[model samples]
Target: MANYQEHAFTHSGLLADIPVTLLAKPADLTAMISRFGNLGDAIDACEYWYGPYPYDRVGYVLTTDGALEIPTNVAYPQFMTTQTTGNNRGLYTHELGHHWWGDKVTPYVHNDMWLKEGPAEYSGHLIEEWIGGQAGLLQAVKDNHFRVLREAHLDDGGFQPLSPMPDEHIYGTHTYYKGASVMHNLRGYLGDELFRQGMRGVQIALAEQTMTPQQFRDSLESATGVDLDAFFDAWVFAPGYSVFVVRERTVNAVNDSFEVVLNIDQKLRGTTVYHEAVPLEVSFLNAEGEEFLADIVASGANALHTVMVPFEPALVVLNRHNRLNQARTANERTLIPGVSFGSTQPFVDMIMYQTNLVDTTLVRIEHIWSGAGVDPATPDVIDVSDTHYWDIGGLWPEGTILRGRFTYAGATADNLDNALVDGDETGMLMVHRETPLDPWAPYPDQTVLAGDLANGNGIVNLDVMRKGQYAFAKSSVNVGMAEVRTDLATVDLFPVPAMDHVNVQLDGGLNGTVRFDVLNAAGQLQMRTFRSANAEGRYRLDVADLAPGAYLLHTAIGEGTAVVARPFTVTR
Candidate 1:
């Protein structure tokens, strides 16, 4: 027989009907009983949606094993009760939530584990909001979103659909985090009442029976009378999240009214159509600083609309309330909904995917500049043709090579030379300068990727190893001659898409003792080593143990930290 202390907590009437019991070592009886309120709170949250805890009694057994829903009881790890890094109550609510999804109704097959685990996981975040507040919930969602994006960047697992999961990844991020994300997205999409009714009805109907995905879908459909097939396809069956951007928004004054014209773009992470049309909000402020809202539904890849407002709007923005799902995180205007972008594609006038300048971390490119921010005089060699400038500023290390595809589409400014309305990239060259004081120069590795002179559409692949003023000009202009950086030691990694090991090459500027660090896509340090090298040398880094995903190489020269991060990937 096992020797253990059993503590019964009626929870001062909180769980009087469903008396809660905790069994653990004699030394921990007092601590377990003190935290018994977590269970009561979980029951309240679950019952609020699922109608009540299905089990007659609440029970938990403290063990070394991770938390699990074992019918009437939960096998909870001892450390979770005092976990400071994460929500400890979340652990409680998750297992107790399973009492409604798993204990009451089981999945017909293990493949359908998402049905129970996903809702349970989603409930954990909801409970955080329940006991704490919206701030708690937001932090929880932010943590999950970053984890999902980073994991997806790690192995593309987070993008996979919930059902038919690979044997090894059935319990992975897609099943739990994405599952929770979809639930949150649906709640926002359906509004609280419909989503609650749909979920509560489904949970009740599937009681005491094996549940399937379709069975769950049918119940929700019957309850709401809103066909959910499209929702399910885009969110559940599909492997990627919907990506939408406010491509263009223009306002013009009419007789006693303001007409607002908007152009919206949509693209799935890995596909074409975004089947579900979640409600999109456009907020406007008038002269008196009063807010007026207009709602639209995001339908497909491209949508254009005109709305009439009663007064001239001072400003307009998308999702002012931040009511949409938090499937990704952002820095300022950076809103990356999926994997980290090493090879970033920033929509000129759209949201950013926070691209970390120091590493290979995926980030959104935000247009954080305004016309009056820093107007520069014409380049030293401005031809008779009108020349325009686009400001660029962000973090960068000494000798870092910044290369990317510069794409310009959609005509905003009517300046003829400002766009490709009818011009061509004949001698068209990409130029940059550290600031307005420096001379403009041509960046290296310039190749014409795409050019549509007629549509004002074109893309040029080029590299500018430093952050500065950039502009497109003809070859007739000669501001400064350049290929790449010639400053501080430049670091470059070789054997891109590396397998066994990768080589780090140093050239131009670099010498003395150097600190080399490796970081996963999430920006977590994976390995660190020191090397003494000449101004130009090579060092080998073993990456066999690292998972196949995006990574960054951080090199520091001498006592001064000159961070030059070059992204590399590992493969099996």
Candidate 2:
């Protein structure tokens, strides 16, 4: 009950020359607090970005549990209680931001909790990014995006609107992470200088008073002098993301000019479809391979447009900056030599998500196609590498399917880490089509696979993945099967492509103690359990909530000897 010593001390510091105190439990937190010093640097950073700190004295109460903001004093989790634990400076910065956000300028109504959490969250992100540069900011944003998507995935159906969200989902991703993400998106929409000016205006307008979503929007409009009603409607009030389907595009070279025709549709799923007001950037490379950029606003159904160019356009690129949270990422359509990879007609679309970090590169290749050939355990017909993220724009008379593959070379481990196609959450890695006549309903199981990622390889198959459909995938922790060494090798895991529940039976039971653990591809622990060896050595595990993907099963005996590990997959 008492392996560690717990003491308390009050350390005085200064932020902007204001008397600040950091009271830590276990006394050991003194070093961490001292190292981090006063909140001066963080406060200065925020002031430079956001406005001035509105509080008199900033004091932090460090406890081993819980975090809450209380006017002049704030309580934070004691993550800095031990030297072994890295200082949670991020958490400290985030809570500190609440003094200006949650306390000073609160939301007019509880429904608009985003005003508090979003600004605070974004502040911490901004501070860290300023200190650590682009990589840090990118990682922060990526983590935020992942959190939002994860929460959305776990949601009963999917993401709800940020504004007027159901009470149950009020504190969910839509309000916190998505709220911050939308702010970042706005920054992208409005150039940095303009966005910064608008932000300053918001802080000044809503200082020391509760504000509503409309009031906040009005502040931004007042500062930027640009109509943001559409922006707020699409990103804030709307419940779903934008889905742009390239119905058709034609490029013709006249005597002295080139004409381009584009037909796009914004047919999105969910109860509310976001009518985004974003610039569509189309790039054309002349015969000399020089690129020219053109911007336009294409909205509504079947947006037909014509572009005139003075030179011959060899290749065209659309939506280069990825300004939209597109349901489908594939924007270019291309020819794949002799491979019949796409649909006969443009029946499917590919949405790819890629991220590169130190020692890890993740690419999520997803195909949205329709047809009868769709099966759950769809074999890899096209290599993912062969497919491009371009919606070729109806260029092919006989369209083809897309394919690609991923290899683990120089990776830290062989395990394909946290990898999953959000659209195919079952980890089936098969083509998922929309329900016939019902966009909200699930498409019938085209085919059932034997297990989750049967071979443990980063391979994908979208057989009969029709044209003009939508699909998405992401790089989850990609990892391979972990190697296991044990005398009791007769462990049996059945229902390869497991559903509902998985059964485990061992021929040779451990005589001592036994434990079990499940890990996702990213090597993150998912589940843990303790089991006593019985006469039959049978274990039935429920897996209804586990997303579809490759997972590792670890069995440990007394003191870790005679340990065994196996790989298994899950499908919805």
Candidate 3:
């Protein structure tokens, strides 16, 4: 209205002509043009996928209130008119996309915000894919897939369904990112030509009219000629994503070919699995640097499937192209010390942190499965009722301590292949062991913290300074006396028989120097050593140097609580 500079640009549209112009302050004109430099490309790409622009004219208007899409006219904030690159172009395309998704084709109800914003956000991907090709689209979808997996459940306002969404979170992460993700995965599911036809039908046939979730589903079903009720019910109407675990993967070399059998299980969240309908891409890489892929389809429940390939594969990976929103970060990476680490498969809320030492370490976390690759040996104590396992590994420095707060399902358990026995949450114990050879024991210092238990959920805190292999079991144990420690605490140790190693069971809340001395029967000290520790874990003492005889183990912690002495025999 006052001193606004104008730059006019023109482009030919598929059906309607687009006379594009950029209007901004004199000082901001160059940056604005740079930001909207791809306006013509956006127009052509949108038309190529979504038909006409749906408006008689379109222009970029700079205003105090920017970043909103009006009918045929686009609003841009002067300050936000930065140069477009990488993903920045998406914003411009999204706002312009609203011309097709919302400005013309409106939502019948507020809950249908996904019908408007989802496609509009997806328009950016379409334009990106249209101009940059399939590689760009794959990258875009992968980014969204990982992002949704990382954030969909913990979004700002918390978890909510895409349809009939809570009024407050109508525009939350699930609506925009997950909605766009659904569209991307749907395109992959229904194939390009058919998916495009279905999408264009929604814009062209339902033009200038209001739409609902049901109406959108009907339009797509009519175009694709495929039933989508289960897909919509599981992905849109529900609150969680599909969780998959490679229960077991075995490769055997046949005559010039390889036979690969994948025992896969569909673990649930709040939603059910749709693996039967949706195709999961599995990639197999041979030692000759060649990669082959196969379409993996299974029931929503657990199953064992087999595939035959021409070449013996060295590695096998699933969902290589990022087709679903899942909680499994199958890839293993190092964890930094003192940093809070969570976001694991199956147990999303399980948190582990190292507090005793401050240095880089080789702690890596990977997938949690029914029985990916853990030994199934049981000791004298056996209670395998509804137990789920998640294993991670890293070396613990001399006295470093690692603590974890385990979060489990409450009632309608949605984790592993089988349900918790009786679906009861009480008496739930989270146990850990060093390896398949080691006996399962309550974490060195274990505490069953109060949690929502009656439903099928509970929490337990434990300090573990050892390599991985943790599980949740539905068994009754004296929670206080669940772990077996050597008779190194008191002069008379009865509950847990003493072993060679000095058991250091310290609570997760304490950090102190643990001192233990082996004294002869004459009250003369034979050997003494100390180690700094925190959380709850144990370490082995070298008794191989001592002569065979009986001795007293004097254990002490901090300043005041240094009064424990236990008698033990060193039979080296």
Candidate 3 or 1, higher TM-score: 3
Model 2 residue 408 lDDT score: 18
TM-score of each: 0.59, 0.55, 0.62
lDDT of 3 by residue, 1-572 (tens): 48988888667776665777778888888877777766777888777767777776778777876488977667876666654464457887888888888877888988768887888888788777877888777666656655766566667355567888888778788888888888876776666787778888888778889988888889889877978776787777776656555556788888888899988767654454454565677777664446798987656767877899889775555665555545454333345665655534222346666656555454434443333222352342235433246656544346666666666654543344236534544445555666544656544354443333344544555544456667765444212222224433423332223345445454344455554555667654454444455455354454544567777766555531334666777553
Task: Encode model 1's per-residue lDDT on 105-159: one tens digit a residue.
Answer: 7788887778888889988888877777877776666566556644642353335
TM-score of 2: 0.55
Off by over 4 Å in 1: 11-16, 34-37, 153-158, 254-257, 285-290, 320-322, 326-328, 331-572
Candidate 2 structure quality by residue, lDDT tens digits, 1-572:
42333233332322345556666645555565654543565676666666666777667776667888876668766655453321355666777778877888788877888888877777767766667776667657655654554355355246577787777777777777777777766776676677778877887888888988899889989988877888788878876555554445677888888888767666553435547566567766664446677776766644777888777775555554444444433323333354233333211222322111122111122221111122232232221211112222222233333332222111222222222221122222232333212121111111122123333333232222332322222212122224457565466788888987688787655565355556788765554444456668787666665789898877765544445888999998
Alpha carbon lDDT at 361, candidate 1: 26
Q: Give candidate 2's root-mean-square deviation (CA, Å).
A: 16.6
**C-alpha displacement of 501 in model 1, angstroms?**
37
List per-prediction Cα lDDT, in the order shown: 0.61, 0.55, 0.63
Off by over 4 Å in 3: 12-17, 82-87, 127-135, 250-256, 272-276, 329-572
Q: After superposing candidate 2, which stretches have Cα over 4 Å from the reference?
A: 1-21, 34-45, 80-89, 156-158, 245-247, 252-261, 267-269, 274-276, 280-294, 305-572
